[model samples]
Target chain A: MSSIIISENDFLKFKEYFYRKTGMLFEDSKRYFVDKRLIERIEATESDNFRSYFNTLRFEASGDELQQLVNAMTVNETYFFREEYQFKCLVNSMLDEITHKKKDNSPIRIWSVPSASGEEPYSIAIYLLEHWSGIDKWDVEIMSSDIDTKIVAQAKRGHYSPRSVMNLSKPILDKYFIPQGGGYQICEDLRQAVEFSRVNIMEPADVRTFRNIDVIFCRNLLIYFDDTSRRQAAEMFFDSMKAGGFICLGHSESMSRISSLFRVRKFPEAIVYQKPLEAL
Target chain B: MAFIKKQTSQVINEDERKTPRDFNGLCVELNHEDSKVRRWAVRDLAEQLNASSVLVTRLEHEDDASVRTAILNALAKLGDTIAMNGLVACLRSEEAALRNEAIEILKELPYEVEPIIDGLLTDADSDVRIFAVNILESLRHQHVEQWLIGVIEKDPHVNVCSTALDLLSEVGSELAIPAIEKLKARFPDEPYVCFSADLALKRIEEGSR
Candidate 1:
């Protein structure tokens, strides 16, 4: 409701409440964004007031409703191959080194956190299949996780709106996705390649369950977290990754502000974070 | 008669002697260094059903995760109001992890937790209030909408107001229009609140229509 005036004190409380729950910082500059979502929920619940609703959110056990609130607040605007350079880097250099370093034919694990409706992971699968020539010899395991159950469900179904695939070349689209209804459904083989799970990185328990990740694609999600949350998240990533693992973040995000746990590795194509093999 | 008494004594084993049967003994066992002993004590305490206070206290200081979990299970099984108290204390905690864990426990017994919901709503800490409201989110009773609306009109906290309004938007009727309009009037500078109230009013109008 445009008329719902949130006082500065209330805004601060919301900021704290949201940060504690989701670890995402709602800064003063993002007031408009936060306010719009908060208003929508206020109306959705039909609560006579804000205080009670906050109480409900704080104490609710299932976390389903809070997840719904998070989903409403977040904007997942992603497309296939949104950043071309990263894919190029992955195909040209990263894979060669990773594959060469392997003693046996152990599967290379790639994690895509906040996989946002399946596009990114599927894009990865497609890229690996098309560009990486040695796919037959090595096993490629992709695990994708998102906080939003609704989005995760969408990711599992492997159907895409035309807008989601706008960046894909026609040949790639013809080979990988089958045209069904108005949107294209990803082929069964590619769909099955990526495993999807609902995970919130803010929760320590949830992050601890993930282990031995070779590479993590956590692009664009860190910008939402506060400094403390970002550090915690960075540590979680570091813990989850195997030694010599690589982390690719959004172009805007840097690990320096969050933590020094990850070392900056400047690749010709993109800057990424790496867990040193020598360091614990 | 002496020979028969000696035979009875011989039949009585050390295992039975060691196991805690009384409340005092079990309470002592709860603090045992060995987790298995503590777990056994927790389970037996649940069977006793009257040792809820001791179990709740042990749940607070218990270092072993399994032992703490066992204590929680025992308290839940006891179904005493004391268990509810333990959970409410967790709601008051500053630690989000503990608060979340308490919420999970309280979620199992929504009916038992209903009475304290109001107290939690009025808690000094905003986080506590938020957690209390979260407990209410699971309940879809007829009175829940009224309770939420009440919070909207009375609660001084903005997060609380926003939370209640969010619930009201889903559960409110045309009757809530006046209160929403009043909310809009109260905060002319808050465009988001104003916009939310306007939207809620529209939804109410639409639902009535």
Candidate 2:
């Protein structure tokens, strides 16, 4: 009849277990945040205490509860200029370096996967147009994909609610979008700039065509996958990239934890991972 | 030429076949000179339920790391008995990279690897037995604690027992307490084994209360 209390011991136990499983560590300051979610999960699962719920989380054959806990713990949102520093790095540091090594007039390729509601791909288009000087000198192709055809369709539509574009400046918005129905419809240039496709990165057939990509923003997607899936995804991305091409993950996600393929490159704007220039 | 609008997505349409994609053809591509061709062959072969036996043969000689990784992923995706056996063979590989990669892949395969884990734990090589305990660290099965207990209780090698004992301190409960005590007694002279077993016991006691 009573709710369970998460003791200090339980907190320590769960913290270590969660960190090992998900590679996300909770500091003492995050105790309230972690415990609130743990108790919520315990209650939701109808388990009397943290022990039973944790046992279910740890040993559940289907691993569904662990995924549920992951969903509860992580924030999933999409917006223009979300983690804007990475985009700044893309324009200031990454693209310049990519172009410096260029020997031909081939177009630069950028991929934003899980094109969630179109914020990320369109944001990349805006960044290159407004921030990068090389946009006029070099041709760029921005291609985005998501596993869900519905989301891919929504992305191609190039429409966004106000919250999705809250981070954009007035000039950037004016230059790129038209105010429509209290929201914004991205201009035809930015919409047509990105090629949207339905792609499951996990499937070999789906990803085989994604060859010679120059930059990839695979932010926050690998966290949901199991270790094998994560490694497989990394392998697929490695094959997809041009030698020395860069990848940007969510700030909290580390490529080192997922795979040994990529070399970590520390730029002033952000840290990104790079495929080796002479990789075989 | 900035943002050149393509009339159609060429990538989606044009995947030129370097080799025929039939079952037998994919198998032959495994021996292809170009590693990328071989890698694609491995990826496509993952769809074939019977590709494991063909893949296992290539795992031994695949020299390119990327291509080898693709083979490992395909093998693990199949995860049938033959595939699992091929992975177990990798534990004995001369290359540490391949062996460690095999361990990581095996950790992903709780169901297929479960029946063979006991044999791995009792493998003739002490190093292989130690690797088996390492697999238990992330098996995500209820039997992991029991497997660790079995290692500490029956494994003759001190290092193997020590590896499992270190894990038990984290995952074991009161069920493992008695074995923890006996393990400390079993290796009275080995400092790490004694310390780890005691730590496991203390943690178990605190946890149970």
Q: Write the per-residue lDDT of candidate 2 for residues A1-280, one digit (tens) a residue.
A: 4466788878888888888778888999999899899988999999966767877887776788988998999999999999999999999999999999998998898999989889999999988888999999999988899999999989999888999999999999898999998899999878888999889998877877787789999998988887887998998899788889999999778988877778899999999999988534
Residue A106 displacement in candidate 2 (angstroms): 2.3
Q: What value does the lDDT take at residue A15 in candidate 1?
A: 76
Candidate 2 segments whose C-alpha is farther than 4 A from its true place:
B6-16
Model 1 chain A poorest ten-residue lDDT run: A1-10
The pairs that clash in candidate 2 are none
Error of model 1, residue B159, in angstroms: 40
Per-residue lDDT of candidate 1, residues B82-196 (tens digit):
8778878877766665676566556456567667777877788877777777765545344566667767777777777777776666557766777787777776787777778
In TM-score terms, candidate 2 sits at: 0.93
Q: List the RMSD of every prediction in angstroms.
A: 15.7, 2.3
Q: List DockQ for all candidates.
A: 0.02, 0.47
